[model samples]
Target: MKDRLFEKPLEKQFEFDEEVAAVFDDMIERSVPFYRQNLDLIVTLLLRFLKPGMRVVDLGSSTGLLLIELARRCGVEVEFIGIDNAPAMVELARKKSRALEADVTFLCEDLMRYDFGGADVVVANYTLQFIRPAVRGKTVQKIYDALKEGGLFVCSEKVLMEDKWLNKQIIDIYYDYKKGQGYSETEIMRKREALENVLIPYTIEENRSMMKEAGFSAVDTLFQWGNFATMVARKRGK
Candidate 1:
């Protein structure tokens, strides 16, 4: 899966990819204020897996929302690196960070090939769906290899499931909820198209297994809201 996701050339240049960026930028901005209300529990759980001074990488970081939030709440001397393949998005992120003078750096690079060697904690929030399953395992292994012993990895994603009915039900609920939150039906359709166009997603079980196979000492789903999930794993120390 990882291979497939990465193999699809990021042919769309950054500036011309505003359609992609708009989908996310608006979505995150709309969702940001609600994070404390909706995701505090999960964020807390993921936080238990971290410590001060950790070298952290926000893989597939879109606008650096999670990176910014984590840094704000962590109260630690952590180095934050935000990685993404989209140059336009990365530049936007850098602009935002500069305005706030936040200590986060955005790198325009593919997560599949990015070196994670010294990272202590890696967080890939809502960005795993686009990763091809074929290279997913290798990507996970690369993440593991990038970490020092006992390092942590947290990935939040949109998952795939075997039950078609359940999938639709979940997707329906998602659309309805988003609509209620002010997204137009057309907007909702656009978002769905973006995911489909990008070839997004993995089954929950497949993700857990991928993490374990990549040499994580332990892997577990810490939280889920319909198809959205937070996966936690760790590299074991000798």
Candidate 2:
């Protein structure tokens, strides 16, 4: 289904509701820059670090697309768990997983409160920005604490530039990119307004600092395009 969610007038703030979930796959692919390529980069990085029987968790795993792909390609025995607060997304993800016969568990739960146990790799693809800034630091700290020694936390986020003029230019470029993806100007504006306060983003440097403060020994960008970036943070020690 195409993403026509914003074509109609929105009565409430943007959310991962049933209506949004219905077309989330389309929405993500079109709205996000280098969506597929980012996922591929994540998989590639995970492949290098994942070991047989290790645990992998995806925070805010809407639609379970990444988990399904990982389950198919990882080949090695590993536990794949997807956590999403949206019940609609969780159901759709589970249905898709069953249809594909992929061994992945999709849980409808709050990521902040969920006990991650100890995972070899934890991924948060465009997830952290939605969290309130006040609690975002504590959330990253929790993710770090949930990782096993030498584990990794890979995250992708929509970032902002520190330079106001540069940020505006990049945003215009991004809007143009959306237009090229077949989204109408109205749709773009509507969605942007709907997500105004709901999706708060951080600067790339701010994101890196948060991870470092959370005790990640090293942090590096894996891919970047305009205002979007994927980064990896490694937990030190064997």
Candidate 3:
């Protein structure tokens, strides 16, 4: 695991630490209904190929939400490793993982530096966008190399859309939804700026091409909501 990934920078990534935690907690507790409404569509499309006892890695796992769902609710006995760069987030996630009794571990390591030697399922839920574009290809290749033959890589992300009108509409609706969930406009702008400063999001087609270049076979979108999408790709069985 790369220690430098956890090197904290001086700039404030979040305005208030407690507020950040509150936002995350509210999202988890109150947003379950929204997630449950879409879980079957997303999970079925992403995990249909997965089997029991396969080791999985959750890259950029925040609060360990998806991994817990996969382990406790999905009935998979796979050992899970959840990696994130935020120490505070990792601590919270570790506590949750312990409380849930899920087969999971949390590591405060950079996704770019982590050695993924035995991953069977690699998940990056809204996290890969933070990777620098120049190194993104190498990161995907690392994921490909880390996987055993026929392993699955699933990612859900907010992407850059090509159509100008559609892109504006997507951003509008996304923030509108966020506002409806009780975030102030100031808070929403701050969140957007923070993400923009960190994440180098790509177009859907660009991501597909990158995955293919990284040696993934059968890359395809499993679910899409405007700019947000879920995709699954497979490593070729040798």
Candidate 4:
């Protein structure tokens, strides 16, 4: 299914419902800036760090395509678990995983209260932004606590700039990029309206600050385009 969801006027705010689940793969690749490239970077990083029997968890795993592909390519017997709050998304992800016999587990649960059980590598691509601002820091802390010593956390998010002028310029450039991806101006505007307040973004600095406070000894950005960025955080060995 293609992303014709926003082609018509939205009946409700954005959500990971059954309807969106049908076209999410197409929607993400076309809506997000450098989405494919960022995912490739994540794959490379995961390949480098994955070890036998290690637990790798993905927050908001969506369709679980990333883990499925990684399972197909990965040589190690690492545990791959994907957590999602949306039942529809989880169902689709499990369906896809079962089709390929991908060694991945899809769980429908809120990440905020989920137990990670000492995971070695945790990923949250375009996930944290949806969390409420008041408790976002606590969520990062939970993620940090879930990891083992010397664990790795990779996160990708849409960031906001404090500078109003530069912010508008970046958004303009991003809109142009979306247009290049084949979205009509009306589609774009309608989608923006749907995502308003539903998708809250933070500054890159704010994200880094949360990681640092969460006990990640090192946090560095690995990729960026317009307002989107991928950051890697490392926990120190005790």
Candidate 5:
């Protein structure tokens, strides 16, 4: 199904409910610029670092598409875990994994409180931005603490530009991009209004600073396209 979720009046703030979960795969591919390319980049980078028996966790894993792809391509015995707060998403993810016979565990739990255990790679694709700014740092810290020495944290987010005018221009361009992807003007505006205080984004610098503060030894952008970016941070203690 296409993302007509915002075509009608929203009853409440944007959330990962059944409606959203049902169409999330389609929505993300169309709404996010270079979504597939970003995932491929993440998989390739992770493959370089991951070893047999290493564990990979994907925060806010949605329908488990990334995990499925990773499992299919890694060609090694690696643990794949996906965590999401939405039961609907978790259920759908579980179902898909079963259908594909992919070795993935999907858990429905609050990410902030979940025990991350020791992981070689943790990914939060477009997930951290939804977390409140005040506690985002703490969440990153938890991820850092949960990683093994030299572990990697891959985060992808929609970022705001520091320049106010440039920020507005970029947003307009993004809206136009959505329009080109078949989203109507009214649907775009409605979705924006519903996500007003819900989907808060930070600047790229601020995101890097947060990761550094959380004790990541190094951080760098792996990929970027206007407002969207994927960052990699490494914990450097062996």
Candidate 6:
């Protein structure tokens, strides 16, 4: 389905409900700049890091697209689990994966409370920002705890900049990008209002600091465009 969700007057705040689940792939690709490139980088990086029999956990795994793609490209030896709090998202993800025969499990569970188990890799693409600011640190710690020694925590987020002028300029540029993606000005503003308090962001430095504080030995950014960035944080080896 095409993304006309915001074209009409929004009845409620933005959420990962059935309506969003149906066109999630279309919506995300259009909304996030360089998202496809980010996913490609993630897949490539995982291929280098993944070993047979390894377990990969995805948090906030809306629609399970990334895991499904990875499962197809990386073979069935590596286990893939995608967790989402939204039932609609999980259901659609399961349906799609089953239709494609992709070896990925879709679980409807709150990512904050879900156990990642002893996994080789954990991913949280465009996820952490939705978490409450107070609990983000604890969540990162859980991710750190779930990783085996030398394991990686791969994440992407809509970050902020400290410089007010630069930040405003980036946001303006992002709005322009959305317009280019076919979102009318009214649709953009409506969606923004819907997400006003729901989608929160942090600075790149703050994200790195939080990850390091959560016991990740090293954190490095893999990609960034406007306000969005993908980063990798490594748990220390024994």
What clash count does candidate 3 reach? Answer: 0
Each prediction's whole-model lDDT (CA): 0.72, 0.94, 0.73, 0.92, 0.93, 0.93
- Model 1, range 89-150, lDDT digits (tens) per residue? 78777887888778888999988776767998888776666666677788888888898898
- Candidate 3 local Cα displacement, residue 109, angstroms: 1.5
Sort the candidates on TM-score, descending order.
2, 5, 6, 4, 3, 1
In candidate 6, position 29 carries an lDDT of: 96
lDDT string, candidate 4, 117-150, tens digits:
6899999988999998999999999999999999
- Choose 2 or 5, whichever is better by lDDT: 2
lDDT for model 6, please.
Answer: 0.93
Clashes of 5: 0
Q: Rank the candidates by lDDT, best first.
A: 2, 5, 6, 4, 3, 1
lDDT of 2 by residue, 139-230 (tens): 99999999998998999999999999999999999999999999999999999999999999999999999999999999999999999999
TM-score for each of the candidates: 0.82, 0.98, 0.83, 0.97, 0.98, 0.98
* Candidate 2 lowest-lDDT run of ten: 41-50
User: Pairs clashing in candidate 5?
Assistant: none
In the range 123-196, model 3's lDDT, one tens digit per residue, is 88777777778888888899999999998888776788899898999888877876676656776666556555
Candidate 4, superposed: residue stretches over 4 Å from native: none
Best by lDDT: 2
Span of ten consecutive residues with least summed lDDT in model 1: 1-10
Per-residue C-alpha lDDT of model 5 across residues 1-238, encoded as one tens digit per residue: 7888988987898899999999999999999999999899898888888899899999999999899999978888999999999999999999999998899999999988889879989999999999998899999999999999999999999999999999999999999999999999999988989889989999999999999999999999999988999999999977
Locate the minimum summed-lDDT window of 10 residues in model 5. Answer: 1-10
Compare candidates 2 and 6 on TM-score and give the better one. Answer: 2
